[model samples]
Target chain A: MSYAALDLVMLGAAALIALVAVVFGRARVSWAAAGLALAVLLVATGVFDNLMIAVGLFHYAPHSVLGVAVGRAPLEDFAYPLATALMLPVVWEAVGRWQPADVRTVIASSRPISWVNTAYPFAAAYLLSTTNISVTFVVGTLFFLVPYNLLMYGINDVFDYESDLRNPRKGGVEGAVLPKRLHRPVILAATLSTLPGMLYLLAVGSWLSGLLLVLCVLGVLIYSTPPLRTKERPVADSITSSLHFVGPAIVGLALGDAAWTPQLLALLAAFFLWGYASHAFGAVQDVLADRAAGISSTATVWGARVTARIAIVAYALAGVAVLLSGWPGPLAAILVIPYLLVVAPHWNVTDERSPEANRGWKWFLWLNQLTGFGVTLLLIWWALGR
Target chain B: MPGVYLALLLITLGCMVILDWRYRLFFWRGPVRAAATLILGVVFLGVWDALGIGLGIFFRGDSPLLAGLTLAPEFPVEEVFFLVLLCYLTMNLYVAATRLLSRRGGVGGDGGNPS
Candidate 1:
C-alpha cells in the first residue's frame, strides 16, 4: 500500500503521458506553460506537499492504490489534473470534429483545462468509494454527483443556444454549443438520468434523498425551460444556479455523519458565497454577449464595476464568516488566506478592465475550489481538534 | 425571523419568475426548467440531510428556526433552507465562470498558441 514503491513509476508514466499529450494534443502550448499548468493541477488536486502541509487538510496516507508516493498526496488526488488534461482534450477533439470549421476560429482559441472548473471532486468521490458502501449512500452520492451535472450542463445549453449559435465564443473549451432544436432531447435525457440516482436513494430509506432528487429535477427543469427560466434573470439566475455548487457538498458532509452544526452551516454558506462571487465575476467576461442577448445578469444589472465590488464584498464576508465559525486556531484561518489573497486584487476589476487587469480574478475563480477544500480541511481538523 | 426566511424564499422565487418572464430564461420557453432547478435544489439538500443523518454529521436542534421540519443532530430546519438557498447561488457561480472562460475579452482559455 505504500506509495513509495510506485513513486518512480507513476511519475515516469504521468510525465510521459503528459508529454505525449502535449506533442499530439493539437492546439500547441508552450512546455513551460504546460508544465506550470501541470504543476497547478497537481497542487489543486492535492498533489503538492506544500499545500497539504500548509493547511493540514489531508495527510499522506502513506497508503495509495497507485503504489507510489506520488509525492504523498493521495493517489485519488492525481485524478484531478489528469482528468482535466485528459477530458478537456477529449471533449475538445470531439467538438472540433463535430464542427471543424468553427473549431479553429473559436473553440480552439482556449484550452478546456483552462476554462472548465475542475471535476476532480466528483472524480475523487466517485472513484474512491468502498464496496462496503451502503445502497443509500451510493444512491445519494450518485444523485448528487451524476445526474445533476447532466442537468446543469443540459439546461445551460438550452438557455445559451442563441448566444452560442450567434457568436460561438471560441476559446478554451468554449462551453458545448448544442443546437436549440436539440434542447428538448438533451433536457429529457438529463431528467431521465437524474431519476435513477434519486430513486435508488429513496429505495434505501433516505427519504430526504428523495426530496433532493425532486429538487434536482425541478431546478434543472426551471433553469432550462421558459417563463421561469431563472437563467435569464440578473440576480435570480446566479443565485439559483449557485445551488448546484453547494448542494452536493452540504449533503455529502451530512451523509458523512458530520452533524449540521451552525459551524457547518456557516461553512457551507461561506462556500456558497464564494461560489456566487466567482459566478458573478465570471459573468463579467461575457457581459457584452449577455447584454447583447438581453440577458439580465448581475454584471449587467449592477454594471461590471459594481458587480465586481459586490463579488469582492461577498467573498470577504464568506471568508470572515468562515473565520468567525470559531476557528480551531489562526493556522486554520491562515490556510484559507492564500485563496483570499489570490482573489483580493481582482475585487475592484470591471469588464472595462483589460484581460491583463482581470487575469488574477479569473485565475482565482478557477482556484476557489482549493479554497473550499482548504476550509474543509480546517473544519475537519477543528472538529477533530487532535 | 423564520417567517421572514420563508417570505424571503417566496419573494426570491417570485422575483426570479417575474424576471424570467421579462427576460426569458431559456428564452421563457419552459417553466419546467426552472421547476427542475428548484426541485433539484431541494433534493440536493434533502438527500444530503438524510445521508448526513445516516453518517452522524448532522443533528436536530430544538431551535424554532425552521418550524415543522425535524432537525437532525444540532442542525435546524433553517439550515436546510440555506442549503437550497446556496444551490441557487453556486449554480449562478458556475454559469458566471463559464461565461468568463468562454467569452471574448477574457483569457478565454490557455490561448492555444501558448507561446
Candidate 2:
C-alpha cells in the first residue's frame, strides 16, 4: 500500500471516531489543545524526521509513494501525529466509559449464528483469488466475521426493536431483540468498532473495490434506516438483502484484484440470484408477521405463493448461471438443487398458511452450511487447477 | 554519539514529567487513568507503525547516533521510548489546555475533581 493511502485511511478513521465520541460518548475534546499538540508535534516531526532521514536510517520504495516531500520527510509521515492528536482523547474517554454488559449486549445483537453467512463469501473470495495469507485476508475476514455482522444485524435489530415495540407479536417470535436502553450504545459500538477494519480495507483496496465496500456499507444502512428502508420495500427488499451477502464477495474479489472473466461474472450472477431467491424465500415465513406489523415485503405484497415461485425460479436460474462458470464450477450447480427442493414443498404456500414455510426456512439455513462445504471443495479444486 | 537519539527522547520526556508535576496536569492528576491512556496511545501508535512496516511504507534507518539494540527489524529500541514520550507530551498538553479552557467556560474539565 502507498504511504499516502495508509495515512489517508488513518486520518479518516481518527476523524470519524473523534466525531462519534463527541456526539455519542459526549467526549469533550479541546480543539485548541489538539491544535497546540499538532503544531508542536509537526515541528518536532519536521526537525527529527529530516535529521533521521538525512542520516540514512531508512528509505522508501520508489514505486510506492507520491514523491511528495516536506524537506526530507514524506508528507505522509505527518499522519501519525495528526491521527494521534485526533484519536487519543477519544480513547481516553472511552477507556473510562467501557462496560462489560454492553459488550455482551452488542455481541448478542450481532446475531452470532448469521455471522458465517456474510464472512464465508469474503474469506473464500480473497483466499481463492490471492492464494496467499496476508494482513488484508486475516483482518478482512475477522471484520466480516464480527464487526460487519454487528453493523448489519446490530443496526437491523435496533430498528427491529423499535418496530417490535409496536409489535404485538414481538414476544411470539424468539430471536435477538435490541432493548431500548441499549440503542445508542449498540449504534455507537457497531459504528465505532467497524472503523479500524473498514478504513484499513478501504485503504488497501483499489478504487473500484473501495466503491464496492462503500456500497456494501450503504446497503447495510439503507436497508435498515428510514427514508430508504429497502427492507420494507417490496422487491427492493430482496435485492438489498442479496447485496448484503454478495457485496462482501465482490469487495474481496476486487481487493485481491481478481480478473473479471465471463466465467467469474456468470458465477457471481448465480450467487446474486441465489441470494435474492433465498431472501424472498425467507420472507415467506414472515408474510403474516410482517402484514400484521404493517411492513411491506415481496411476500406481503405479492402473497406467499408468488414469492415462493419467484424464489424457485431464481434458484433454477442461479443453477443455470453456475453452469457457465466452467470446469469444477459446473459441479457446484448441483448444490442449488437442495435450495430448490426446500422451496419446492412450499410451492403452493398461501398467505394464510405462510407460517408453515418457516420449516423450509429452517432447512434453508442448514442447507447453506452443506452448500458452503460443497462450494469450498469446488473452489479448492478450481484454485489448484489455476 | 551512540545513544544520542535515546538520550534526547528521555530528556524531552523528563521535561513533560516536570510540566505534569508542576501543573498537576496528566499523570500527577490521575496516575491510573493517565497511565492507561498513555499505554493505549502507545499501543495504538505501535500497531499503526507495525502496519506501515508490514506494508513496506516504513524502513529502519541504520543510524549511528543510537544503540545497536533493536526491538524488531527496522524497529529500533528508541521507537517505544519515542512513542511513550509522544503520548505523554500529548496528554500533558491536553490536560493543561482543558484546564485553561474550562476556566474560560469550556465544556470539558481536566478529567479530575474541580480544583
Candidate 3:
C-alpha cells in the first residue's frame, strides 16, 4: 500500500510484459540495444528523479520505501523510468500479446469455496489483536483470501494433475484436476498474483511477521512440489499442512503487533492442533485412491483405521489445548466436538471402505461453515467484552 | 521568486534538442512523427502527474528556485517545461538506440553511437 510497494508491483508487471514481447513476439528486439537504452534511462532517472524530488515535485511516505535514496529522491521513483524503458519499446514492438488462459478453469483450480478457511484466521487474528482495520489487515485479508489460496492449490493441482486424474472425487468443488495445458498459466498466475501482496505485507509488517510469512509460503510450496514434496512425507506432511493455516494466523498477530501472552500461545497451539487433525483426517478419505495413484501420505503409510483414530485423538487433544487459553478462549474447545463426531464414524473404516470416509469429509466440509460461524460469534463476544 | 527551476528545465530541454539534432535522432530523424509521439508522451505523463497530484501523492515543493507562478493549484508553470524535457529525452534515447542498432547492421556509419 506504500508508494514504493505499488511502484515495485508496476515495475514487475512492466518487466514481465517486456519479457513476453521479446520472448514470444515476432518483433526481434535487439537485446544489446535494449540493454543500452535501459542503462541510459536508469542514469537519467537517477539524475532527474533525484532532481525532481529535491525541487519538491513529489515525496514518498518514508515508512513505505526501502529508504535507499539517490541524492534526495526515493529509490522507488526510478521504477517509473525503468518501467518506461521496458514497456515503451514493447508497445512499439508487439503491443505485448500473449495467449489467453481459461479463467474459469484457473479459478476452479484454486478451490474457491475454501478461501475463507485461510482468510478467516488471518482476518480474525489481526482484527482481534489490533481491534481496528489497518492497511495490513485489509491487504493481508485480501491476500489470504484469493492469491494465497491460488498459490497453495494451484501448485498442488499442477503437480497433482496426474494423480488427481485417477481420482473420481476430483473435477468438482473438492478440486478440479488441472489440465496439462493450463498447468503453466495456473502456476504463473499463482506466483505472479501472490508476490505483490506478499511483498507489500513484508514491507508493512514487523520482522517477526516477515519471517513467519516466508516460512508459511515455503510450507505451501514444499507441501506439493519437488524432492522436498512434504506431502509425500508422513508426519512431516501433516505438520506442514497444519502450518499452512496456523501460519497465517500467527503472521496476522505479529503484523498486528499483538502481545505474545501465554493465552495467545495456548490459542495458537489449539488452532495448530485443529489444522493438524483436519489434514490427517482429510487424508484418510484419499488413502485408497492415493495408494492406487502411487502417492504416499500419512494415511497411506499408516492406513485408514489408524489414521482416523490418530485424527480423532488429535482433535480431542485440540479441545484440551484450547482449555488453557483462559475464558472465552476456552469456549472454542466446544467447536472441536463436531469434528470429533464427524470423524468418529470413520474410526473403524478399512482401506477398501476408506472411500466412504469421503462422505464424512463432505459433511466435514459443511461442518466447517458452522464451526467458522461459531468461532466468529465467540470472537465478537470476546472483542466486545474486552 | 526567480525562474531558476524554469531556467534549469529549459537548459536541459536545450541539451536534449542538441543531442537529437547532432545525432539525427528523434525530431531531426522524422519531424511530424517525432513531434506527435513526443506530444503524446508529454500529455500522457502530464495526466499521470495530475492523477498523482489529485491523489495527494504529489505536492509542489517550496523552493526559491521555483517561479512564483501557478498554472493551477499546487501545480507550477515549470512542470510543463519539465514534462517536455522528460518526453524529449526519452524520444531521443529511443531514436538514437534505433539508429545505433540499424547502423551497426550496415557497413560503416557508426555516426551517432553513444557507446
Q: Candidate 2 clashing pairs?
A: A57-B61, A58-B61
Q: DockQ score of candidate 3?
A: 0.13
What TM value does model 3 have?
A: 0.67
Q: Per-residue lDDT for B13-95 in model 3, tens only?
A: 88988888787776675464455345434543444454445445557778777887976656788888877776676656765
Tens-digit lDDT string for candidate 2 (A1-386): 78788777667767887787777666656677777777888898889889878977667776777888889888888888887788777655654454556556667778777788889999999988898877688778888888888898888878877566655533432346667766766776677667767766776788999999999999999998888989999899999999899999999999999999999999999999999999999889888778777888889999999999999999999999999997899888899998887789888988999889889887876898999999999988888898
Span of ten consecutive residues with least summed lDDT in model 2 chain B: B106-115
Compute the lDDT of residue A217 as modeled in candidate 1: 55
lDDT of 1: 0.48
- C-alpha displacement of A348 in model 3, angstroms? 1.1
Q: After superposition, how far is residue A203 of candidate 2 from its true place, in Å?
A: 3.1
Tell me the tens digit of each residue's lDDT in model 3 across A1-386. 55665665566655775564454443345455556777887888887777767666546545566778888776766766666666545433332122324657788888999899899999999998889875567768988998899989998998998898899989877888887767765765575457557766776667889999999899999999998999989889899999988988988898888999998898899988888888998999899889999999989998998988889999999999899996798989889988988899887889888888888788878888998898899888899898
Winner on DockQ between 2 and 3 is 2
Estimate, for each residue in A294-371, the C-alpha lDDT of model 1 and write its tens digit. Answer: 777777777777776766677777767666555563344454466467556666665666243346555664565565
lDDT, model 3, position A151: 88
lDDT of 1 at A91: 22
